[model samples]
Target: MSTSRKKSRKARASRESSKPSKRTIYTAIALVSACAVTAVAIGLSTGDSDDGGKDATAATGAQPSLPGALGADGKGAKGKNGKPKKTEEPWDGKVKVLGDGSTSYTGPQPNQPKAEKLKPGQQPPQFIVFSWDGALQGDDRLFSHFRQVARDSNAQMTFFLSGMYLLPKSKRELYRPPQHKPGSAAISFATDPHIRDTLEQLRGAWQDGHEIGSHFNGHFCGAKGGDDWSTEEWKSEIKQQYSFVQNWKTNTGYTDIDPLPFDYTKELVGGRAPCLEGQKTLIPAAKSFGWRYDASSPGDFQLWPSKIDDVWNFPLQLLPYPKSEKQVLSMDFNFLYNQSGDSTEGDPAKYDEWLKLTRGGYLNGFERVYNGSRAPMFIGNHFENWNGGIYMQAIEDTMREACPREGVRCVSFRQLADWLDAQDPAVLAKLRGLDPAQAPDWKTFLK
Candidate 1:
């Protein structure tokens, strides 16, 4: 990049970290000072697939092979000499191709609600964003399940697509993950069938109004992972990720699958890195690419977000742990890791208690924002059935309990971005004054 652009990014980052405000915006901004409300947002918002319960998967062609139980260990099938491999049946007879036959722009993002300024003195709605990483539809089938859950609860969520999930194992060699050898990936390559199933889900989710962000490829974590990669390496990894998604048809020679809805180039905004590492380098790329947000940061306090290089720094927040006086990151893995160390199968006796604790952490996090700062709750999870799907239940319970309450809108990160953009800067400045625990008297403070 250019030196001038680098200087500008540094300036933007400086502005993001140092905000000029009296008290905490979370506290003072809560009042919204009647003057801040310019216009009221009207109408019920639309989400991914709002066609009155349309079955987006009722397609005539493209059948995915039966999915199997696979781990993210990169031990799936491979081609001879590590080159792009093939399947017995590349694609079915029916095929719908789009730009370069890579991805087709189906239509406008389904049900994307237009953001409008808040009415004077109207308290901002409590925004909660639930997201998943390494969006692979494995034997668990949680991807489709959560889609139903979100639909039932009238919420929209984000699914960060792991590029390797779509890349057929036969063509695994095509991926050159940063800091890793060619054809090598930290996450297991999906069998052709898993990729097919994931594609189907991706189509349905995008059509249903959910957002798809890049999880990059190869769940490389720990040493020599994203944390160890440089900005240039990150750029290469990102480019390869998009390539894997767009060129899946050619890689696997698959036909008959309808193109995914929405152009990915336009749809993708930002993502969390593997293990929440490598963001210092990643943010520069995000800024240059004009990504709206980056969620790779770890353990943030529950507060309204600010930009990093003019891009939203949507970090995973720290949540109160009922079991301990300490706090935990608001992610399922963190809770589980704390509860059972690294073991997926912890003592069955503590199952209920662990689940309750996870649920409590999420609720506590939400409550901290809803009743206090009104910061958007960011919860991340995987599709794994760790601890007998307790995390899933906890999240579902949180959604059910928290979403139906007054002034709550469980939404995608994209929606949160729009809402943040709609707010008046002065009002936002005041809102930023609030510490997560600090709540000011609305009537008196706004006046």
Candidate 2:
């Protein structure tokens, strides 16, 4: 990281600590129904919590090999050493600019893995998706940093970009969020420099083979949020999300930057809702647009994904919270809510311990599926440096440790969906049936 970037991170952290608002609250409103099994309570929203508890896990030693797990090249019958081989770019076509030069069609995306069906008696690769919400390139430069992180780790990720991040604060009234005043929003609009930086990051991210999805606009939660909106209201919100991104060149009146490399309508295939709420209506609205998946559901076990109404329901998962029987949602906010209770800046003396516990919890989840069922792991995060930047460190460490392991493929949600679509449905059903710790005899199981 550069000196200027380090200073920016410290300045952002200071600002967040001094002026906490509804957007920075990180509150847990109510636990998801699935968490009832483990007697754990947590919610997804912006608020406060008073319960500060710590938990750790015993290491599940010795990874049991999947008998016939495929290697990185996607053709070999078993695992191999070193980094997974990335596929070459599939298209070399002419760019076609569209709609006032805000976006263009640049042919098929590059460096994506080929979605091949599992051979008979072969085990599937271990997949882990590291996604970011509210993808903004603030003064902290986190968006740009993580792009380099992904390149180093040989991973492709999903960045749910907030549409309003592109619309300047000067033109705030251009947005009319449902059930709120024309310009009102739960989150702050990006500054002019931040908007420009975010645009550059989005452009590079897509070109680098990362999926640029939506975080919607305005980011309303709790009352009058996605929860309260009807299907039609959800439709209106979705429409505005597209409008803001598609018309950013007009909205910002900037001419020097190149148009985004891919068309928004075709590139955008999914999104995660604010607070992981409103999937009930959001799904229907999304389906109308032919979206392939939705990642807004709050909690589920670390198992293979299944469809809801023919749309891939990619929910945030529940991972083992170390040193306890309870499970926490696989998101940075949940970890912060549990360890420090509503405070982004917790006790300084405990920062190292908290970082260990956070990193351990994710690793525990990874080891379970890695050695046993081989289900995909979904880890979500934000760019904000909460708890002295421990969570950001935890994620980066996890990616470096996990992505290069044999038979492990760190992919974007879109790539995961494509792989799932190519598999035999009955085989997927069988794989989904295995417990998170149940390593099966692949030769017999798939046969």
Candidate 2 contains a number of clashing pairs equal to 6
Give the per-residue lDDT digits (tens) of candidate 1, residues 94-121: 4434444657655466788778777655
Query: How much is 123 displaced in model 2, in angstroms?
Result: 1.0
Model 2 segments more than 4 A misplaced: 1-26, 29-92
Which has the greatest lDDT? 2
**CA-lDDT, candidates in order:** 0.67, 0.74
Question: Which 10 consecutive positions of candidate 1 have the poorest summed lDDT?
Answer: 12-21
lDDT (tens digit, per residue) of candidate 2 on 1-447: 234323322221000011112344633444323223231222333332211211111111111111122222212131134212222235557887877777877888888899999999998899999999889998789999999999999999999988888888888767667776666666778889999999999999998999998888767666676787777677666667766777788888999988998777667778898877788998877766657799987666777889988789887777777887667778887788778886777998999999999999899999999999999999888887888889899999999999999999999999999999999999999887877778999888897
Q: What TM value does model 1 have? A: 0.77
